[model samples]
Target: MSCSGMETVDELELVVERLMDAPVAAVWKAYTDHLNDWFCPPPWRAEVQVMELRAGGRALVTMYGPDGEVVPNDGVYLEVIPERKIVFTDAFQAGWKPAGPFMVGIFEFEPQGDKTLYRGRARHWTKDALEQHKTMGFEAGWGKVAEQWEAVAKRLA
Candidate 1:
């Protein structure tokens, strides 16, 4: 669907837009400061090994499951707008080193009256990867994370 003469990208997957009951500044703080607390779904946990929070800065995260499974993710911040947006990709590591591309994640926060509109999108490298991610429960997982994020934001507010 096209709106205002602009077409949405077809390659975007796991896109989620939610209205949070907090201001953008609070939400941003929750996202950046307490990421390890709400980044993963239930029964799983996130550990932020490193987060630089700037363009070309590093973000190394590891997710651990209840059963002790660990998944490492290393990425660089492509863009960062204070209290507004963040774009990161696993396509390149810190210092502009090329790595195996998995997904590019974009998160946007908008001021909506007394609340904030949170939008999230994950861009996959291939259709198969997209399908695989969907099958792996992207909605449920990301939705849970979003709920957790909102809770943190509201608490911070």
Candidate 2:
């Protein structure tokens, strides 16, 4: 349940990968510094309340839906590899205190010439959770967010 550098569990994970038209550095900067600008898809917006960006640091954000719905996510970073990878989960808080876990999120950005290969994954603790994520439109939602992230990276490039 620590999920630090854990391998993907096919039955409990959903992923979104993209070949972005931007450099790794730019992509990383956008992700680390401008998360609120691209973390959510259109009709929704995200505000990063805290993003310490180091192992055990806090990763908190509030997402707002167009219809006035607010979703606040609070988590801690499990690992951070600069421009390479980021792993976080709500399983633990900033002091490693156990919480009600939903999933572990892993995001990787690989350098590919002037472009970057980005992969985002959500690993759930149970099959029911995974099913719930699927029912919530995980693929389409994450895919749209990826596209938005890529655009932000491109602008940063």
Candidate 3:
């Protein structure tokens, strides 16, 4: 799962990587089964309404802010490799129906002895979309989520 020397197109992608102190299996389980526990940053919680792990399956989550703000994320899984990788996008809905796309999200869990190297990439369709995501606190927000995920994974270990 080493993406060493892979040149990133800054105009289209944003990434967050972390070396977690938990095994790949634990990390994967935490992500797949306990997503709502660590998906959003503090004061904001996520609810996994529908998370079908297979390709073309629905991946719907509703995020709730402490102040009562609600945001729903509706997408379909593009790829799923147990304990290894997950690729999803909003480009299509259930049954392969086309829809307005935002960005493709890729999450990788690489085994490293007793630890896991987690990489998350968000690829946007355009530079503008990428910029918009950056403006929306992609770095800090995702970074916090990564930390939260690591904590949950550690607990699973």
Q: Tell me the TM-score of each prediction against the true structure.
A: 0.91, 0.92, 0.92
lDDT comparison, 1 vs 3, better candidate: 3
Tens-digit lDDT string for candidate 2 (77-111)? 98999999999999987788899999999999889
RMSD of 3: 3.1
- Which of the predicted structures, 1 or 2, would earn the higher lDDT when compared with the native? 2
* lDDT of every model, 2 decimals: 0.84, 0.87, 0.88
List the pairs of residues colliding in candidate 3. none
Quickly count the clashes in candidate 3: 0
Maximum-lDDT candidate: 3
Models ranked on lDDT: 3, 2, 1
- Poorest lDDT segment (10 consecutive residues) of candidate 1: 1-10
List candidate 3 segments past 4 Å from native: 1-9
Tens digit of per-residue lDDT, candidate 1, span 84-155 = 999999999878899988789999888998789887888898888788878787777777787899889989
